[model samples]
Target: MSITNRYLNQLGPQLTERDLAIIRDVGRFKLMSGGQLERLYFADCSDTSRARNRQAVLRRLTGHRVLARVGQRRVGGAQRGSASYLYTLDVAGQHLAQSTSSRPRRPYSWYEPTVAHFLAVAELYVTLTEAARGGRFTVLDFQAEPYCWRSFGHRTLKPDAFVQLGVVHPDGRRRKGSFFIEVDRANQYGAKIETKLPQYLAYYQHHRQTWPDQSFPRVVFLAPHEQRVSYLRRLVAERPEAQRLFTVGLLDELVAVTLDR
Candidate 1:
């Protein structure tokens, strides 16, 4: 039987809105951690309550075979205690949402190496969601992975994610900001990172007319550590045009500065 059929047979009509929301988020991000879900879905509660509530919900979903654990331990953050399980929509979970098609399942081993990359992307999404909730800014639009890709004639610019932000000023005026996020894990050579800059520049130059009133989305590079962040900053500084078009910082710093501006 297909995953959807199996889930229906086992769980019957027990699914809830929260359950479906979890499935939708997992399907959308391709991967998410328990902590990210808590922030996105359960932020109103105290941290202790949030942690307890999130764990309970995740356990029930996993037990029902709706969500599959992708990693043995959490990939990001410095929180104490056992790490959160990284999650992806199970076969049954995907069928609950649109735009997701069934595909052959990969062995569990395949996800281990890519968990960090997925977590990095998830972290950015979680941060933005939190910022929106705080009322500092509103997330006008967010697109991940393939959805965030854009074609410019012969070339394609695939940002890790694209976000449209509406920043609320002290006087209560909201200004629009758009950005393309690049989550660098320091896995690529410095030269490779340097090479990617020109493609962004080209995309901005070619697409200016498309968004005449709005500036080209600034490219924000979220580096894993300070050294990588510094290196990227130096490289961006060398090119005057790039200096204006790009911003680089460690994840925590970016979260504070980007949304606050």
Candidate 2:
């Protein structure tokens, strides 16, 4: 955690603007997939060119130890490839990033479930930004975990992210939406998720000074697929009180739910 300004200065000369952004973003998300990086940094390129350019830069960064790859994810039983990599900051990268957050935020220490869950949250962040780019709404604010976490009564409700979106209605009135997002990769048991519902209900019903706004923000559960969505919907349905505020959907449906599209 201790580094001279000269050491930090030295990193800047060896990296590009894009390189620094990548380091900081990986630090921000705690973990990221290569595809997520390409979408954020190389969207202007053709699909083929983007993959080639992304891999080229990522390879060089790994060689420099400016970035580190954790593990490969198998896709539909396919073998590991560059796209399957999940990246975190290396030693040099940690110094460059100057971050000390996440689950220790150290390289090579994360379990596979931890990596997959964080990556899904990272993907949702990307999806929101891409949606805002379409001009229907503007991204007012977005906060990832710890920052997004809310504590009420005796317990804490940790959401993946907290989001605010600004929209201009046909009547020329501006409206803003606040939401708590929970991304599910199908990693937890149904019982575990069921426990989360009550925490949110308590957070909403209580008039705690900790709650950000007067009106309660909609709580969204984004699952990996429709089947997961159906299961979650059934669970939420069991709690008649939750039906009004809680909505369940596939992760890809995030923008539609948030942006009201």
Candidate 3:
């Protein structure tokens, strides 16, 4: 007989089909592994009240072994020092309940997506650095959290990736300075010139002064799509100094520039 049927046989007719359905759904929810299940329960029991209790009872009845500890992905916020724990379940323990798919997914707020994209770009930055014949430079997360404000303070700034270049200028000048790559895949049309450009200008001006060393600080604003290039022109027009500090171009153009290096 099927495992679910065998388990249901013991639970008896007293268990309604609906109850069985719930058990099946709760137990077999393999969409998330054991660790994820534990995190869901611990984060807010209210949301998981029914499922959590059902899972606990089902495990006991089925003689399923519940592993004590598991690791959960880091969740940050006001509870900064807090950590996530995982709960592991044995084969039988995990079997009684059917895996669930309707469970709520973890949310990625505003900055999360931006930071994630930046990390992806940073990986490419590392590859480009290695290929450029420049000393390999480490990617910096200048856009992360509170650091973004401090690093790009006085500007409306969002950076994709930052790296220290190992190559010297063609003039044979000292191999000094780092580069800041600001990626704007789809950021456009927010309050237009009155509000947006000023922010970027401020950020660049502040960023330039923040560094103590004489090393050059350059900005490469990437607009992957052709449609986005117009915004770049507006940006330069509103903030003239940006012409000196930044280069606005499409992804293909950026690729061309980098690949030539």
Candidate 4:
């Protein structure tokens, strides 16, 4: 059965229950709204009769003390529109109101490599640079590549593409210190990084040993693809050191924002 139907059925004959359930299910309940009560049942009533058997049903279902009003709308015939109501569920009936505290998390979906992805990536990087501006990394030292790593060891380390940020001196000077980023999608393993990992490792080792005076730029591994994220989790489980030198992040959780916004 539909959610609304099930809610109505669960309400049973209690008018308060029905009213609360209907409002909650539809997400349309107001605390101080108004509408005419649409009486489903018909009963004999003259112009002078203030109440009828149908009205009595409401009184019996809800407590007779509850407040209500009568009204109608225009229709083709003189009977006017069917009498249905828009009513408020107030704090006085707090116990009868449904909770609206939480909702399920929105499902995350990856956007495959496309024009949108490319544009989005560029936009995101720019935003990140702006957000991190005036820090150690300078805008002039920032560089982005479409794809730039190659594997070169016995283990066939994977080659991961990067977006880099580096430090620049005030006098238009360039520094050897640079940080790299790797965005993984699908399965990191299946994404073919085995042959290219050595390059990254070599770079990591070189920077660490050679730059005793200056700090090496940090490497960030971002796993946005579900498969890649799963692989990363497993990779980290097997080897915790993966997170030491190169920080890992989930692309799925990264918020996408426009450059202007």
The TM-score values for the models, in the order shown, are 0.83, 0.83, 0.40, 0.35
| TM-score, structure 3 vs. true | 0.40
Pairs of residues at least 3 apart in sequence or in different chains that clash in candidate 2? none
What TM-score does model 1 achieve against the real structure?
Answer: 0.83
Output the better candidate (1/3) by TM-score: 1
lDDT of 3 at 30: 16
* Model 3 stretches astray by more than 4 angstroms: 1-120, 126-130, 133-157, 168-174, 187-196, 204-216, 253-261
Q: Write the per-residue lDDT of candidate 1 for residues 1-261, one digit (tens) a residue.
A: 445565575664687777776776677677777778887888878967877777778888877667887645645566422236777877566555543334322322334556676667778878888767778788888787677889988988878889888888889987888889888878843225677799899998888867767568888888879899889999998889888888887878766657644
Q: How many pairs of residues in model 2 come into backbone collision?
A: 0
lDDT of 2 at 187: 74
* Tens-digit lDDT track of model 4 for 1-261: 223534544543455444543334222212111212322122124643423433454344334212232222234533332223222322222222334313211211223333233333444344455444446444443333323333333433232334444445568665543446555654443345433344566765665676667664455556666666666556655645555555555654432211111
Order of models, best lDDT first: 2, 1, 3, 4
Better of 3 and 4 by lDDT: 3
- lDDT tens digits, residue span 231-251, model 3: 676767666666776666776
Q: Better model by lDDT, 2 or 4?
A: 2
Each model's lDDT:
0.74, 0.78, 0.43, 0.39
Report the error of model 2 at residue 163, Å: 1.6
Task: Please give the lDDT score at residue 130 for candidate 1.
Answer: 77
